[model samples]
Target: MKFFSKRELIILTLLFVLSFVPVVGGAIRILEIAGGPSVAPDNPRISNDPFPALLHLLGAIPFCILGAFQFMPSLRRYAPKWHRLNGRIVAFSGIVAAISGLWMTNYYALSIEIQGDLLYVVRMVLGTAMVLFIVRGVAAIRGRKISQHHASMTRAYAIGQGAATQTLMGLIWIALLREEPTGLMRDIMMTSAWVINLTLAEWIIRKTNNLSVSGSVS
Candidate 1:
């Protein structure tokens, strides 16, 4: 049997494409930190304390890419062992990403112009939510509550993909306004990306659950 239906394959393709820009950006940042001289003038915060950023990038890259596959029902049904193993990796990477993100948000010496108060609070809340969602997903899987596990993991992955959505939002803001957003506008743009992703995630979860119920009933 095919691993994914045509529609599933298209969705997976879109997910990977969304991750491409962020993954490449993270790779370039990693290279800059590892190879360049100390005190990067362009991004002093990352140059000064690269550990958290590195951790977040490493975790987020895998979580975003590999976690996308977990949404494939055919793959999960056919390859249960792979699903379980990949799910573990996804959970661990998600937790690491969330913790590192929170750490950087709290401790990094970012100026208010780059990261306003609202953005700071939003990051903290979303990062904490991602970690909790991953933990709950694992607990639900352990309890054999497959639906809960799927929902929690789906929410966590949605939060994890915020970077991708942020990129899209940034492009839209630039195209529409003819200038990059800053300060409060930037915060709103970034927060709106997360909000959009979570809203879609919730909708997908509900739709999937409804479909499952209808399938069983029929």
Candidate 2:
């Protein structure tokens, strides 16, 4: 049997494509930190305390890329061991990403024009939610609540992908406004990205659950 249906293939393709820019950006940041002195003005926060940024990048890259494969039902069914192992990696990576994100948000001395009060609160709440969702997913799987585990992990992955959506949102903001986002507008754009991802995640979760119910009934 095919490892992925046409729909699954499409989803995976989109996920990878969305991940490309963010992954590359993370890699560049890592390289900048490793190469030499802090030259990037916008990156001084990370340059001063690179450990959390490094942890976040290391965790987020794997979680965003490898976690995409976990959505493939055929792969999960046919290669349970790989699925389980990858799931563990994804889960651990997700926790690290979320925690490090929170750490940076709290400690990083970004300008109010860049981060703002609203953005700070939003980041804290969403970061906390991502960690909780991943923990709940692990617990659900351990308890053999497969559907709950899937839903929770899907939500966590969606939150983890906020950076990709934020990139898209930033581009759109620049296009529409003819200038880079700043202050409250930047906060809105960033928050909207997370909201959009979570909304789509919920829709997918509900659709998948409905399909599963219909299949089981038939």
Candidate 3:
């Protein structure tokens, strides 16, 4: 039996706390309690439409659940079917979320004087790309091109996962850094995470492909 080292244990503990913290739980509760976007406040840019709020609430639930399993291989073994079911759920939910987000982004009528307008455009672009990549990946899978499907879906998932991570980071920063309510910061973090995740996913694909080809040749 392998035991975690001190550093590993500490890291795992932090990850778990972040995954199941009251703060995260509270945020989720608020969204769940709100029921949908229509019930949310209409101030600032995001409230103009209910789709973004609904997308946000829908995506957040499964994202947090999956984040927990990310660190727990044992949990995966016990529930292989559950994991597959959740994956499909996340994929479908993500599409809805992305579409609504994109629509909201365009309809948000923030002025140029504020950074929120630029951030909305950035989010729209990234969200569109994320949705397109996932759709293409699913199509590839249906055509039986397993490797292409894997790479594309992996990239899509990475982008989605990264955005969630950025949201968590923003929550932390807001709680700790005494940052004022700059609406743009949330969008910036979310958009940047998508870019960062895609870059990392591409690099991973390249490296893995090279290694596979080398092994096959040998």
Please give, for residues 11-81, the per-residue lDDT of candidate 2 as tens digits: 89999999988888887787777875443445778768889999999999999999999998877878899
Instruction: State, as a TM-score between 0 and 1, how close model 2 is to the true structure.
Output: 0.94
Alpha carbon lDDT of residue 144, candidate 2?
95
C-alpha TM-score for every candidate: 0.94, 0.94, 0.63
| Per-residue alpha-carbon lDDT of candidate 1 for residues 1-218, written as tens digits (9 for 90 to 100) | 66689988999999998988888788778778788543323777887788899999889998999999999987787888998899889899999999999999999987887799999999999999999999999999999988898899999999999999999888888999899889998999899999999999999889889988888511
What is the C-alpha local distance difference test score of each model?
Answer: 0.89, 0.91, 0.60
**Top candidate when judged by lDDT against the true structure:** 2
Question: Can you tell me which runs of candidate 3 are displaced by over 4 Å?
Answer: 1-52, 63-84, 108-117, 168-177, 181-190, 214-218
Query: Where does model 1 exceed 4 Å of error?
Result: 36-41, 216-218
| Best of the two (1, 3) by TM-score | 1
In candidate 1, which residue pairs get closer than 3 Å at backbone N, Cα or C atoms, i.e. clash? none
Of 1 and 3, the candidate ranking higher by lDDT: 1
Residue-pair clashes per candidate: 0, 0, 0
Q: List the residue pairs that clash in candidate 3.
A: none
Error of 3 at 171 (Å): 5.3
